[model samples]
Target: MREEKGVIIRTLQEDINNLKIEQASTLHQLSSTLSHLSSTLSQVADLQHEQNALRQELRKEQNQRLTIQEEVNRLKSKGCQCDNSSRNSTLLPHDIQTVKEAITFDLQLEMKQQNDSIMSEMSRMEKDVRDVKAKIRATAMTISGLVSSVSDLQTQIYFSAGTIRDVNKQWKTNEIIVFPHVLANVGGGYDASSGVFTVPKSGVYVLTCFLSTHSSSMYAKLILNGNPVVGITAVTNDVSDVDTGGNAMVSRFQQDDRIWIQFYIGHFLWTMSDASVSTFSGFLL
Candidate 1:
């Protein structure tokens, strides 16, 4: 009876030790899992932060664009005929000539003023764009840092971000691809022709177009989705001087967005000289 009791006590001791071992193993596994989860959450938080920063930057850009557009509209309204009625009351042939001359002078002055205003507006727009670009660079840097830190925590959390150009050969006219959007073609034409370009994906995209001219007083205006954008003009009447050169138009696109460039076509005689139409190119960011 004494031997049996001793055996029973030893069995109980062994079972207790086994249970303690199992408990320790469970605690270790839980700790590891919790650590991994914490790392994942950290990465997610970083990404969310990046997204919010980008949104703020985007809002700034949009506000700038709106401001510029308003300025443009104001300028357009000012483009109407300059009124010089204060100097027009004396009716005589000589006075009429004088009035005509004065009106011409006033027109020239207004034109100069308009040109100056346009330059100022353009400078502001460029500055704002640069600011946005800097923000993007900063965001990219932040992402790089986050990615580096998370690399040790998880090997599969890296994101590939870059630009790709000329993904497809067939582009439609008037198709514009805005940033955060894929490229789209509105109508089909190649080389310097004005048409809409569309976006197939949603992301940031950089766009470019090329147009050329061989005649003086000839200008090409690039329009993004029916909105007038950049303008290029030739200084000489030589084909090669303006020839072999293409007007590059760039704009950010969104999904299902459209863009295109239209030339004044009055003096731009080189549209079909070298190429049949204008060509548009862009990439995903």
Candidate 2:
């Protein structure tokens, strides 16, 4: 009986030690999980801060673009009237070229920065995923949220084109005026052959058209999916004088929607010997 009692006590003590070992192991695992969660939270906070900074930068860039567009509109409002006006009108195309170049440069820089940011974030995320592979169930929601936020920062789309040659009386009413010369097609949405811009993505866009005429009156319409949105006309009475007219509109478009310039009412569209006068441009906002 005495031996049996000693054996029972020993068994109870061993079981108690085993339970304490298990409890200590569980505490250590919980501590590690909490630490990982804390680190993940800190990373998320940093990413949120960076996203806010990026949004502020984007707003500033958009404002700059609006200012440039206003300047272009101001210049276009001053049509050719006298000899001095004609001289200034000659410079108008150059001014437009300069503005386009500046916009392209800024867009390129912005795209580069955005690409770098995306790549860096992607690399960091990959590392985080690898580090937390065993804890995927815990961090899955956090990773998904980060991916969604990054996706919101999309790239801009824009295009600018000009009439390559003199569009004579061959252009009839309701005909699409194809601008064969592409000055800039950043998003590859404009087709020089078809003279149509196919919407690459669904978004609000700014469409603009500028026409120049010599000794004739010309009218053009901006068409969206076979519907006329706005019209522009340039009328010149003197053979030696040039007149300019333009129209700009902001509208929404869906992916695969078509946009083009149509000859609404015009005898002919003229182009300068050294530069193009008729231009069509658009950008996604």
Candidate 3:
């Protein structure tokens, strides 16, 4: 591994050195080219100056008793550097300067376009990041709400029970005991009119049932999901007449499971307005 790392480092250093050498060579070449261009422009300007001087001399000689063709010959024989025949010689310098200006302008425009593209790309990426963060925040809030709701459901409980007030149903089979005096129905799981308690959520629940007999004996079964799960018997033969019995048990229930008290064999129970006459209850563990 160390040998590999040394080789990689050596390779990178060599590459960097080569790149620097190439860059320096390119800069030298560019400098030489610019110097040559400047020299040529200067020489062209000198030639134009000489040409103006020759024109001035020709004009003066024309006024001095000489034929125009002879004056041209004299001007040519004087070794004056003037070529009126070709216009390209004068225009070439301006063209070269124009080309240089155009190249500079194009380079500047290209650079500006590249910079704008980079800025636009950066802005788009920033917007995408912001949108992602917003979505994450919203998702986090939804998850938190769901967790809170689940916590509440996990810890919830319910209970209820009662007996009818002074009303006497003498004797019958399958008689559902209507607990009329509602004492504690915390979660509204029990319906007083139906004489039944429904499971609010599916879980293990503790249920209790009780009844009081007056002037008679009472027998009932705690009915759960249409089946008897527990039984209660209370007998009162004396005039004092307040025999009470109850049972409690734990059972698993599903959603909307039903429970109630059902009297069997015409057994009787009495409900009074006073507290503790008879009561039933249930709660989650």
Best by TM-score: 2
- Tell me the tens digit of each residue's lDDT in model 3 across 1-285: 224324533654564466556556655655555555565556556555655665565455444424534544554543233333324365434344345446556655655565565556556555655654565565556556555544554444555556546666576777787776676666678888888999887888877776777777778899988999999887778656677777778889997999998888534566666544566777765
- Which stretches in model 1 have alpha-carbon errors above 4 Å? 1-194, 238-251, 268-278
- For model 2, residues 1-285, the per-residue Cα lDDT tens digits are 224324533554564466556556655655565667777667666656666666676667667767766764554454223334656566445355455557657766866686577567656656665555545555555545544433433344778788757766656789898889888786799999999999998988877788877767778888889998899888888777777788888888999999998887757777866666788888765
Off by over 4 Å in 2: 1-38, 41-146
Ranking by lDDT: 2, 3, 1
Candidate 1, residues 95-206, lDDT tens digits: the string is 4445555655665566557556655655665565565556556555655555544432231110111112222222233333222112332222121222445565555545
TM-score computed on alpha carbons, candidate 2: 0.50
Best by lDDT: 2
The local distance difference test score of model 3 is: 0.64
Report per-prediction Cα RMSD to one decimal: 40.4, 45.9, 29.6
- Name the lDDT of candidate 1: 0.45
